[model samples]
Target: MQVGGKSQTTWQPLGWTGASGGGRVGERRWRLVDVAASAGISTQQVRNYLADGLLPPAGRTPSGYRMFTERHVRALAVARRMAEGHGWARTREVLAAVHRGELPAALAALDAGHAELDRERAEIARVLGAFETVLDSPAAAVPRRDARIGVVAAQVGVRTSQLRLWEQRGLLRPHRQRGTGYRVYDVAEWRAAQVVALLRRGGYPFDIITAVLDELRSTGRPDRVRAELARREQDLHARSLRRLRGSAALSDYLAETVPAGTH
Candidate 1:
């Protein structure tokens, strides 16, 4: 539906608004709501994107009504998809490249994002390997039940704060010594601490470590840790694939539509 000068209070599907009164693809024009409806976003969101130099500027009607075309719709669509895995800032750079008709730059931005995710996946693998190796070792079977926090930290090469943070987050449950109430790391707890430290060094968030540790403690299976990492790996892999597909789609759009200009 077309709203010439007034803002739309409710959203509706876009309909063709005549700018040249022609049915041809290049001759047709759309209102702001029409573009918003076509893109499945609110008019305010489109305005915000426009202000951020995300959307191409709309042409003005004789009486100052904003006019849009299919090009704008396509731009918004690509912007939304690019924002999914790559953050808004990165998406902005990518979309800017696309809107300026720089397909290579846009695709390069996508490739860079994919490469970063690849590095992240490799790191996850390394961390999971460390966790599994520690779990499988005979040395892990020995109980250093009375080991203090400092000793455990020193042995594992972690800070006391790291251990305390892990314990606070429910990733570890080191026993407290009687009277003194100091933390005492048993064999199992120390192993868990090692796992946490390795994962942290490899860039796993504390919450994810907590969940993986909980699964390990409940199932007593070291493989559960690998399973969690595998799930994350699959998720990142899927997201990377989607970003590539979006890049292809954006390339197609850039090929067809001319960019407004450099922002």
Candidate 2:
């Protein structure tokens, strides 16, 4: 059906005798109600899916109605299946996989697995890069020389609140002025905070971070500290890989059983 500023095509189940199916591959657009009916869901549910980022942005008519494309319909169907059948919380993962490379025969299932792996690999690479930067930089001689919370947080891609929390936990001790109460940290402290931020981003919990910080503070050996951090990062990477694999497998299984046309 062609409406105000868009077009739509309906999907009919394939015929047993191989006749022309009701659905057309090149269908250009769909109304909100049409999409909801085709996906066996309510219009409100469709809106909910869009709000949750499950569906991509749809074309809008001059009359203010949403118009969906074939791709959008297929994607929404896959996302609905994954969420309802496989318990997947994120739809972006499936969509990303589809966009990353050529999709396989079971597009939705393949996308789910690929997306999870891709995410983990990217995260691992980022953490490893941070680890390398910290280990390679020369340790500053003075411990509390030039730490700016905002600057350091921006440099390390962490939140300022995180830096403050680390300071409160004694993991970082930037110099404080007695009269004005301004916090200042030296080069060494700044480097230490950078290292802490790297590990925290790699998913290290507070307790482990505290323990590692304590060891570094007590010993003050750059080489030993670097080795310890590397070891911990490797260990965490392995654990993350295992979890990623498990999540992919679960998603694949769920995708298989999900109803194909569910919104």
Candidate 3:
């Protein structure tokens, strides 16, 4: 990042190899405006990053002005990537730890985020499996065309109170019959209820069952439901890759900045 005319005030490599064993490199002192322009953020935001410990402390000039350097710029770049991948809260943790020269703590925070992603992936797999288990179960028909609460309870083999509880838990949203004020279940609601019943029978908790019902309601077809879950799986994979990239960048930065035999 350079400090000059508009054309010069953009991002250019301040010379980071993104590789290990290059300790305390890049001696160029950057300007605040140049750093802000290069990162496409405001000067105030850069200051906020400093205040929030998202970046290492900037050096100070003899005149008491903040001294921006190539190291600060590289750290900002890494923080941006980590924020995208590990999320802001964990990003703050990693950045703060790294600035403190506690590389192990920074790595530990990243590992924790990856562990969370793993748990989410596993939960999605379980939900998909549960969906398959209850896919073949028949939805009990309403006696008449009315698809009211008791009718659905009888057909789904659930108590009326249980249905009401599901409604309370936001698992169901049946419409009310005008003037009679009774809950009315439409064809789609009947389908959702069927899903809830089978998952409940399989002993899944409300949260996991919620995932299956959400996909089923939104997609309205078995193939579409499967596709949506697959898309979620792909998203998890993408996030995992992003986190890996962030971790690599941080490792490279630490190796370059920390003096030999100090870390």
Candidate 4:
């Protein structure tokens, strides 16, 4: 990347002519195979990137062979790093900005993505802190076995429809009384309801909650909370690292390309 308005480095494209190599002996073009090898990625992966419009199209020789350059290699490296960091959709945004010659917009997109990650990590930490506070608080007295849906819903501070939706998603299953057919929540169900409520408040996805609940039911593990939160922390840390590397690559690309465009 550039420093103090001066371009730091530029990569020059080179041509090789060898009959045993990817292209014809007299050809000086960089072949697709050569580009893939240089980039340390699969040929199919490069093609997939081209299909995704992440990489610009290659120049074509008279025989219709794809020809790449050092610039293409640099672009591919940046795209790969972005994919590793920000995922497909976010990567596409940054790539599109760069493609349109919007370097600042690309940097802004990276900033936004990382900011979202920071918010999510902070939310997870707050949830964990709240959960610990809940554990330390004295337990409320047990309710009657015939506790109705409305009562449970009020206690959990969620709407009745939300509780029903959770049940519809197979997350909760309160018993239906025989005569009135009203939903009934027992002690065990109340505990499950509390767990679901806390998790939902923490913005956990349905599938993750379902999986954790299933594991809890099958294994009776008391360490599920610690295990799940620990895994989430590790995942966020890894993502942060990816974002850092991706930003570096994008900055380098912008630095090398911007000065050339100015001239």
Candidate 5:
């Protein structure tokens, strides 16, 4: 049937306007154990999902035993997939809002996850741009020869104490002379210091600088920057796909659920 230019689904109530998670009227009920078996999880785990708001409320027998159906089963499966993409904490928030009949809150939680990924992608692009700029600057290359802390600090125009602080923060690591106990940096570490100096001048935070230098350190060649960025882009794409899949599953699961307060 078509309503308001949208195709109606079998599992949806004649009107599915409320919120998610309850069996449609007249569906045959299943035991809680049956619902657990259908999803290959232990009954105790299913109970935990219920307590955790990962599944919708179950029906009840006249004698007060818990009753369930495919609605609950689909909720379990859809929730697991949502967790796979959105993380367990986020999935719990979404599901809890859903069971409370708060569809808007549930959708907002999903939107926030997508927005976070969008921000990460933006950061990756920004890092790539900054990295290219730094590669063309005086920070371009490092010699394999060793340099003491003072020399590297002078080359980067940063105070030696600042370099020591960066080391304390785990932003970079330099070697020590075997007996003299002096900090010494070679090509890889010097390049890291230079990158940190350039990014700090550009106002990048320590966390982002760490990520940039970590990636750059993998090969230490300017030409390899794009390769790393490409790999990171691919990872983001995979995560986006997983979230999309989770949303699609959620749509189907919601359609099958009875309208809130109708049961």
Candidate 6:
């Protein structure tokens, strides 16, 4: 078949035999341009596949134009299939394997790797879904500022005195209303309070904590915040692992001394 001035070949069934016209079984041939167009990829990509040894060499027409045989089309289709079914990263590996005559093994490896990635992605998605559910619940409501210092402290599971100390140290600045003669904290202040609580829990001194918060507030860049948080998380994770190992060692020591049936 030809469409839009490009010659195309209908992919015959697997066992199709040409009608005694000297063509091989399932041998519907097409021009390179047509195959590239039908494949929905650039002609350069097809050429790259051929150059990269993913596809077999193309035959030439009488006028010197490049023509593709049924086998070439099949190879291109396989490459496209791999690229679509798996990701580009794995597709390159699979294509290299195909070139090296280990296609079956490559495909099996791709399947296993894809299955593992899918499992991991599903687990992550499940955790995210659960987090979203909790976030949507009424118990997770975001509190408004200006209610009371104690209210903010209670909401964040911190003491009012700690919050006041943070405020005095310039780590947090709540809104002050002249008419009401009261300091009311908004969401930003609440977030600052949470940061201060985390820093205090992490054993950071009040002076260092104040400086960090000051720099963060002055910059207000999400990237800086993300990098800082990532570092903190890594440090906390390492500390927690060390604590867990220590606890396990203590438990083992106790198990060795105490009788198994002790009350």
Task: State each model's CA lDDT, in order.
Answer: 0.70, 0.58, 0.79, 0.71, 0.80, 0.58
CA displacement after TM-score superposition, residue 76 of candidate 1 (Å) = 2.1
lDDT of 1 by residue, 1-263 (tens): 33797664331112323333222346567788988998788999998887775776566667877777776777788788777767788888877665444556766887788789888887777556656655554443335456899988887787899889878888889888999999998877887887777677767676556655766787687666677778988998888877777666665655455333321
Off by over 4 Å in 1: 1-26, 85-87, 100-108, 148-183, 192-221, 258-263
- Model 5 CA lDDT for position 132: 76
RMSD of each: 10.0, 13.6, 10.0, 8.4, 7.6, 20.7
Ranked by lDDT from best down, the candidates are 5, 3, 4, 1, 2, 6
Error in Å for residue 2 of model 4 = 29
Q: Whole-model lDDT, candidate 4? A: 0.71
User: What local lDDT does model 5 show for residue 163?
Assistant: 97
lDDT of 2 by residue, 117-192 (tens): 5665665455445545556655434334465677777766678888788888888888876687777767767767
Q: Estimate candidate 4's RMSD in Å.
A: 8.4
How many angstroms is residue 197 displaced in model 3 relative to the true structure, after the best TM-score fit? 1.4
Clashes of each: 0, 8, 0, 0, 0, 0
TM-score for each model: 0.62, 0.31, 0.76, 0.65, 0.74, 0.39
Q: How well is each residue in 129-155 modelled by candidate 4, as lDDT tens digits?
A: 655544554555557665888988888
Query: Which candidate has the top score in lDDT?
Result: 5
Q: Report the CA-based lDDT of candidate 5 relative to the real structure.
A: 0.80
Q: After superposition, which runs of candidate 2 have C-alpha atoms over 4 Å from their true positions?
A: 1-145, 225-263
Model 3 weakest 10-residue run by lDDT: 10-19
How does model 2 score by TM-score? 0.31
> Candidate 5 residues 167-201, lDDT tens each?
99998799899999999998778878888898898
